[model samples]
Target: MTQRTDVVVIGGGQAGLAAGYHLRRLGIEHVILDAQTAPGGAWQHTWDSLHLFSPAQYSSLPGRLMPAQPGQTHPDARHVVEYLAEYEKRYELPVQRGVWVDAVHRDGTCLRVASDSGEWQARAVIGATGTWTRPFIPAVPGRREFSGRQLHTVQYKSPAEFAGLRVIVVGGGNSGAQIAADLASVAELTWVTRRPPRYLADDIDGRALFDAATARRQALDAGHGDTGGVASLGDIVAVPPVRSARDAGLLPAKPMFTRLTSTAVEWADGTLAEADAVVWCTGFRPALAHFASLRLRGTRGHIATVGTRTVDDPRIHLLGYGDWTGPASATLIGVGRPARDAAREIASLLSG
Candidate 1:
């Protein structure tokens, strides 16, 4: 059975919720298909220790500010889930949970979205599926030969699970720093990165990052020279746990090792260390396999877009995939603008 609508937003996470808000505000009939079984979106799937980079008030959806958690400067994952679940209820967003989208392809003048629950034929499709489902690990040589467990950030939770094990935490991003910090007290931890990890100023948080991104976007829109945004500051923000761990020398990062062996990893200058497990915090690619039938990806695995609307197929838009789609769009506070853009553009396209 094919259900017709003006829009079909995939992934009922933050991005999808953001898009739904704008679509509803514009009176655009749409439904959000979320793969998750419950409300929180991807936040529910994050590690037990995961926390937002900014305060709850600073990180929020378009129309709702996440109420402050009583004692948290930065709300933990559960708080975020609570906020999201409540936000969905408050706005009464049309979300169909537990529906995994199988594929999206052109069907005449519309886009046909095939999913586990049913089918949706929409005049425009918002591909808001974020990257949490697609964790990426670099193709380091001999990775398969590792003797012990290999885990990605998506699989990681509390550090108690790997207590006393020799663990190498890989990647230079915030996830790497935080997870390594979490493991310091219990595990024999080695934090590995391609280069020395860069830490932003102690005071910097997601607020600063968002402001810098806004400045950069404005400068570019004004036809001015490039102003480096978050990258200009540093890769990892000095979140409390990371700062404590780094300042205390509990999170010293080693240069990335050359390859893995049956029992250990070998470094370039003839150094080797035995490891019982490896935890990869290397980040994620956009969860876009469902859009494969659209044949829209470039060699670099992205669809060309003018704002959120795909240049290849104007009937489709992408949201919250990262900076490429919109400045800081993947963050909780960042997805709103592109979502509104997508809604406006879809409104204009369909009306014409």
Candidate 2:
């Protein structure tokens, strides 16, 4: 049996929930299909020590302001998870959990969304699946043969498991820096980067990253040149913990290794370091596999989009992947505007 709806949102994360909120406000018939069994989206899978760079007020969804965390300016992962769980219930959003959308195909006037549960035929489809499931690791030579416990940011939980061991964190991004800082006291930590990790001025707050994301988004939206968003690897915010780690001389960068030697990493300088574990913090690509069937992706492996709508297929809109779709579209506070615009456009199309 084919389930029919006016709009089908392929994720139930911050992006999908935000879209649902707007769709409900517009009185549009919509359903959010989520792969998770419960709420909290990807926040449920993040490390226990993780905290947002932005404060509670700055990280709100469209209709709700996340309550401030006690004694902390920025809330931890648990608090964000609780907020997401509450947000969905408060709005009575129609979210069908555990429905992993596999592919989307053209079906005359509507798009056919095939999922684990069944098929949904909808007038419009919104792809909001964020990148947590598809954590990226670079293709460094000998990575496969390295005789060390390898993990990505998604599998990281705490420093408890790596105590008194040599752990090399690879990548120059925020996650790499944070993980290196996190394991400093617990492990014999080594930070490797393609380039020296750049930090914003200490006086600059975390809000600066958000500001840069919004500004870059505006420029892209205005038909300006395509530049990377704040999420790019080079721009590390001087968050309190990261700053402390840097000031204490705990965070040091070794040039990225030329290759991995069975049980070690060999740098271009011929320096070899043995490691008990390696954490790959290389950032993620968009979770766009489900979109394969539409043949919508251009040569760049990304759907050519104009303000969330696919240039190849007007019936499909890709939201919340990153700034290419909207300002900070991947973040909690940033996804609202794009979600709103997508909802309004979908409503207009349905009405016509």
Candidate 3:
């Protein structure tokens, strides 16, 4: 027999948990299904040596603040995962761990969701899975033929692991810069960006840059955008962008790479760089393929919609998509707004 619920959440991350909490507050019943043995999806898969660029004050899930001293940096991967685990216990959220959802289909008034554990029939379904379900590694020609250790930035942890080795760090985004910088001291590092990245220092002291970026990202996503790139708010304000890093000879400012041969990377300008390992920080993609019926509005992976409502299906919603450019958009702040709205929408459908 298929168990039933008012709604079924596809993920158990911050988005899913927040949605579930809101549903409960409205007296709506829902179940959270997650594949991981525990909560914190990205954090569970993230490398050991990582910290949120955003500070503790800004990274709270929803109701609880990330416990920390005022100036302490935001929690690391371990701290995040532990905090999420504690969050589950605190609210008694009805989450089924280790239940990987395989497919979802509409069944009359309710949606049928099949998972590893069993099946669920729900009046509505929230795709709170977030955007990082799939890693977006670019297709470099002859990549398969390369014999060296090719790894995605998602699995990377520390620079010590690649110490004394020649490594090619691909992509110009935050991950690429941070990783390349960290590895430079220990390894022979070469940084390659498709284009120059606009780096912003958060505060004058440079200690709170992550928080600043998160704030900007949040604003942009909320549609109340600000001057793009980066802004430093407190402490030391206005530090140079990463272009200065290039000028200072801390990194190489090579043009975009043409292609990757089995043993070397060909630059756009007729140059070959040898590498023992290539760290592709190409970014992430949304795994919307699982829901075959949810149509995307445009060529972009984004599902075009009016506000938080999906254009294809009002019952489905996406949050934390890169669309929000303000500080809270990318970070955990203000996510509660969309999740709460989504939960209310689902409850309304169920009540009707």
Alpha-carbon lDDT, every model: 0.91, 0.88, 0.70
Candidate ranking under lDDT, highest first, comes to 1, 2, 3
Better structure of 1 and 2 per lDDT: 1
Which candidate number maximizes TM-score? 1
* Candidate 3 C-alpha lDDT tens digits along 1-352: 7999888888888777877778888988889998778777678777665566656666677777777634445467788788788888898999998888888887886778988788999877777676666778877777887777888888788877899988999877667776776677678888888766545444323224444555565676678957443433321122233334455677764656878878788876768888889998888876556576544546865567554557777666665554331123335655666677777777776777
Worst 10 contiguous positions by lDDT, candidate 2: 226-235
Flag regions of model 1 displaced more than 4 Å. none
Clashes of 2: 0
Worst 10 residues of 1 by lDDT: 300-309
RMSD of each: 1.0, 1.7, 4.5
Model with the higher TM-score, candidate 1 or 2: 1
Better of 2 and 3 by TM-score: 2
Better of 1 and 3 by TM-score: 1
Local lDDT at 105 for model 3: 81
**Model 3 TM-score, 2 decimals:** 0.84
